[model samples]
Target chain A: MPQTKTQVLKIDKLSKDFGYRQVLKGVDMDLAAGELTLLLGKNGAGKSTLMKIISGLVLPSGGKISFKGQDTKKNPQNLRKSLGMISHQTMFYGDLTAEENLLFFSKLKKVSSPREKIEGALHRTGLRKFAQIPVKTFSSGMNKRLNIAKLMVMDPELLLLDEPYTGLDYDSIEFFNDYLAEFKKKGGTVLLITHQIDISFELCDKIAIMQNGVAASHMKTASYTYDDLIEEYQKR
Target chain B: MLNKILGIASIISIALVGYLVFFWAPIESSMGIVQKIMYIHVPSIWLTFLALFIAFLCSIGYLWKRAEIYDVVALCMVEIGVIFCGITLITGSIWAKPTWNTYWTWDARLTTTLILFLIFVGYLLLRKFMDYGEQQARFAAVVGIIGFLDVPLIHQSVTWWRTLHQPSTVFSTKKNVIDTPLLVMLLLSLLAFSFLLAFIASKRIELELKSRKFQKQIANLPQDHH
Candidate 1:
């Protein structure tokens, strides 16, 4: 009984170009509420560009992006307040402690009771023990964990993650999956970009495969086999 | 409420000092009636430099903390400094016509004032070149701090290298030449100028915030057509 057209995000005729190179051309897609959508592509695919456009970090050359029935182009700041993004680069201040970093962004987002939220985020991320240590002192996997904690503090309506499992160990990946499962259970929409097909199959309810600056295919998780996707990606 | 009250107080004090400068303070025997210009001129120059210094400090703070509000304050101070420096040049020219027998001179103070004017012009130009938001602020903050370093050197150049300009007498404790009435007028002008700087700076800060929001809107326009 899911409403297919109850779109949380709608992108139409999106195109982006850099000089002579076209990165995204006439890409169209839709995302629904409470659905975890996995974006699949090789290294040169325009997945990151599409996410940047959605997050208000980069302006598209041409297109319309609407979120929650409002035009993202008209209300980027308000959209940004509701959208949480975690990329490969941990966006926290290196000189500040984990708790301090969360506290600062929380205030920037104008979240009330920031200190209490910081403590809650730290506890959820299992970094409560290292909360006082500077982020620069943490290992790569630990830093990513803190990044997740930062996103959790905001409680965003839409979460965009670019390669969130890049440097994690097997145990950390399991921990991340558990957190994501809980996040989806709470009705938070997630758009994840990753090269790993197994993770996509295990986590996503819907999948979009991009190639040559456009979405090559969009299908339900059950419609395509893992080998079929790998073959389709290899052919392009 | 406080700023409004302060603005009114400054206006009243400036009026009283203007009366004192024209009537109560005695004209100097050497420089004649034109010497009275210093009662307003010197204090404006001093306050301008003081405002510039505050701007430099605020710029440093903005860069270090990456706060948008600090950049607003720095921009305000730079604008106020430019206004005062303009006044300094005009009043100095007026004073020079009767005292030095020329409307303009390449004296150290005059040269330094010109340089200070250019520095603020560059600061404003730098802001124009930037696309706005955090990068513009960081660039402006760095330039503001570096530009204000010249202010102290400019003030000292008259005394430091034996220039044709007279050294500071009001600030020097060893041989101050200002009389009591003239001193009171100068002090009152100083307070009045400071209040004016504060009032204008606050207004400019509001404008900067508005401009930032407008720029964001303009940048987002291309993406709405699809």
Candidate 2:
């Protein structure tokens, strides 16, 4: 069987359960290139589980997931190489300097010219000045910036962010939004899970509202109003 | 660079201790020249337990924080403990030949040391069965913590039970059993062996980290099919 072209990521009949509680039930979705898809729902909506499944951190109980027209089940590591993720965890050694952190991740990603790539990522994330400081001394916003820098070191085609704006101040959030705008301009794809409706409205190309493990509604930015999404979310 | 310097210093100290044990220290009149083996035997046994204790600490740290470096440190310590255990066994056997009129004995200290060696072997074998990355780390940490529990048992078995073997004299401050020259030789050998243990552990950890990096690269290759 042949595959479609527009789908960068495809999840079909995906269900996950922990013991007797089914967190996701027959969840289906498709993400296309150059699209910033915002996944929104209340707490315990299985947003993180879905993201983890796509990132190859966790396997679904029942589902088929494809990345770039390749079956993720058979080739998860290869598929994972193309993904960059930012979660609540910093995922870097606190004692290492920001540059060292970036270098280590770049090495893990097998990037050629790791030093140059790390330097470029630091510059892009506006973390060049603090590159020599240990991450333990960094503020939460600064650490988030370094986390973004580490992700960029991989040059991943698919970027996954789970509550990336959770602890950021207004200025930091604005800075992150500007960075995402530029990231999308360069034909990058993003799957972001957040509860912040205002940021979703301003930044996302499409909004996917997940409830009880299924994507209840997926609409383009022009198709759904803020009130419409809120109503749909509450109704579920 | 720091490791290389430390390695050189350990080698020099070990050479000095070797000279002191062979030529400078006095031989006991009771057991004759065989008693001189205490300089090597006691230090090796002490170092083996020390390495295992460090492994235990590192395993606890790894489990508490899930840090990869702590896992590496624990793994390195296990290998060092095994090497020191082998040395302890060899030196003990050498001393046994002249004193006990045999190459081996079923004494409590000897039996416990043998069991400790078996546990160290089992730890390495368990590590071999595990796959790479976090799973390998977690499995190794569990094994390390369990394997280290044997060290204390090995140390206490001589005192706790009536055995033909002598009790531990490594930490004793008695003046009658060991004279000043033999004591100094044992202390110097202990210091040298501990330094050597740290040096080898550091090198092993570096190699382990490099191997993990290589494995990750191999996993990422497009043509290498899983």
Q: Pick the candidate with the highest TM-score.
A: 1
Worst 10 residues of 2 chain B by lDDT: B166-175
The sequence of per-residue lDDT tens digits that candidate 1 reaches over residues B1-226 is 6657767877787787777778787786666788777866888788788879888999989977766688888988888888888999999999888766788877666878988999998999999887655567778998998888867787687546534445544334422566777677778777777777777776677787788667656644443221
Q: Count clashes in each candidate, considering only residues at least 3 apart in sequence or on different chains.
A: 0, 0
Name the weakest run of 10 consecutive residues (lDDT summed) in model 1 chain B.
B166-175
Can you give the lDDT of residue B81 in candidate 1?
87
Q: Give the CA lDDT, 0 to 100, for residue A93 in model 2.
A: 94
Which candidate's DockQ is highest? Answer: 1
lDDT of each: 0.80, 0.79
Query: Per-residue lDDT for A125-200 in model 2, tens only?
Result: 7889988999899887888888777766787878899989887888778878887887787777889987777775
Clashing residue pairs found in predicted model 2: none
lDDT of 2 at B144: 83
Error of 2 at A95 (Å): 1.1
